[model samples]
Target: MKILLIDNASLTPVNSALCCEPKTGEFAKELQALGNEVTMYGQIVESENIHAFNIQENGINVVGHHRRKLKIFNYILLYLLIIPQIFKSDFIYIFYPSAFKYISILCFIFNKPYGLYVRGEMGLKNGVSSFIYKKAYKVFTVTDYFTTLINSLSKSNIAETIRPMINLNEKDIMPVNKKNISGIFKVLFLARLEEDKGVKEILYAIYKLKKMDYNLKLILVGDGGYKKEAMHIIDKLDISDFVELKGAIYDIDKVKNMYLDSNVYILPTYHEGFPRTLYEAMIFGTPIITTFVGGIPYLMRDKFNCVQIKVKSVESIVNALIYSINNHEKMLDYAKNAQTTVKPIINSTRLSHAEALHNAIHNI
Candidate 1:
């Protein structure tokens, strides 16, 4: 089947000697592997003398449309252009509801089948997304909480919950060390350095732990708009000796190494649709310490696969960290359990995009 993927994100050429962002690139590759002719339509900010369209790595075709100067106007123009293309495709898989709603009118007009995939929390009080939720054919979300939110917001009662597919192979999962590593416990916080991502809370927790003489090393990965603010918090707390902000790591192998070296993965995010980092941490057999927010609790069970802390509380996070360090064996058990829980769900061979596309196509 021919599938036209409309992505608002940037897409460079395959021969550009640059790798695309892992998550988006993985999904694109998956669609291509499924024998579907995948055409990616993404943003092109500046004017290029050469052609815009290019075949990316793994044989995926990408078309870059120009959007100069005016940001809102470009998006509006893209939305208008996308409507005509939607009628030509066999299936329409949209990423967010706002864009989905904008495109849904065309699908509704033409009597076409379209699926909405919500990647983050959508049902905030008085948000514009509530209207978009009501128009989708089938709503797909990454977590149970998001599924619940979609169901509550949808007036038509057409929502199906499906977990985001992670492309995990044997290489992704590190061998579990049954023997515990001694000395300072390594903690990893892998996400965008944003206030909502709980970077400040993690730093404060680290400070509290250090004062109590808990040997810990914190590695902060991923760069975001909040880097300066987060750095200021790190400096203000004076826990620079224990915490190291390794900004924007894109290499998959290096990310896995960070996970392999760490004893615990802490993500005290205030909100999320479903965090991919949690799954990445679990795949590497690292015990997780995260807040009970969004889809986290759905993927993890307290005292079973991970330890859940209260959101925005330094005290809670620190206490949880101390508990995890002292009870290292239990943490390891949880890590092992996490590996068990996530392995089957994210395994690429068993359930590929080919299968998902087949399912979507057959249903349509």
Candidate 2:
């Protein structure tokens, strides 16, 4: 089967070749490994570095298209370029809502079947979203909460929960009961450093921790638009020694090491559908400090398996960190609960997700 995956993620092309984001890129490789001809279409850097239209990336074929400055013109050109791929692919799967708009029209014009994969609920509340999801061949959402939201908002029982396609070795996963809270008080923040993700709040929280003379260290393991600003604040706050901005880690082993070493994982994002990082932290038996937003509420209750902090609140983040530190036994218990919650889903291989894709396409 020739499967075409579309995403709004930017791909940098040059001597480094085509860059695919880890989650989507790894999932595409899984599809290809399943004997399916998989090709991904993503945004290419609009620069002189433009090379071939398609490149083989980690056993998967990646097709990148350069973007136009004008937003309207960009979509027009994007649709024109993607029309050919629409016909070429046996099944079309799109991640992200922006690329989802009007692709339905192109699919209908070609009489091709297309599935929708929504990672978040950002643009899910409007009429346009309702119509699009209602018309989709299948809708794969992240959590049970989001699944219900999609069906309710669309007024159609079309959305279903899809397992986050993460491959964690069961044997390597630290048993939650064996989790240790006493150690180097290190915090891990492993997501894009965006304002919405609460990077600034976290930085301030670290500063507050320092003011109290706590020898806590923070490791930020992702980069985004706010990286420069985050760095500026780190320098401004004079907490550089306490913070390490690792910047967009691709090495799973290195990432696993960070998770294992950290006493707690924090994601004080203002919004989310369900972050896959939460599950990663859970597998490592690291206590989680996050806001109760998106799919988080469905899986985690406050002071249950995770510490729920107010969104965008530096005070909440600081207090949560302090709470995790002072209450070792309780935090360990929470980590254990989190591990039990995510174990089944985390243990499932990416093959399960790929096979589900196959099943959805073939059955549809």
Top-lDDT candidate index = 2
RMSD of each: 4.6, 3.1
Best of the candidates, TM-score: 2
Clash list (residue pairs), candidate 2: none
Candidate 1 stretches with Cα past 4 Å from truth are 7-20, 42-58, 63-74, 97-101, 124-137, 144-163, 169-181, 347-349, 362-364
Q: Scored by Cα lDDT, where does model 1 land?
A: 0.72
> Across residues 262-288, which tens digit of lDDT does each residue of candidate 1 receive?
888899999877788888888888889
What TM-score do all the candidates reach, one by one? Answer: 0.80, 0.91
User: For model 2, how does the per-residue alpha-carbon lDDT over 75-132 read when each residue is reduced to its tens digit?
Assistant: 7887888888888898888875766467876786688888888877677787877777
By summed lDDT, the worst window of 10 consecutive residues in model 1 runs over 45-54
- The residue-level lDDT of candidate 1 at 24 comes to 61
lDDT (0-100) at residue 264 of candidate 2?
85
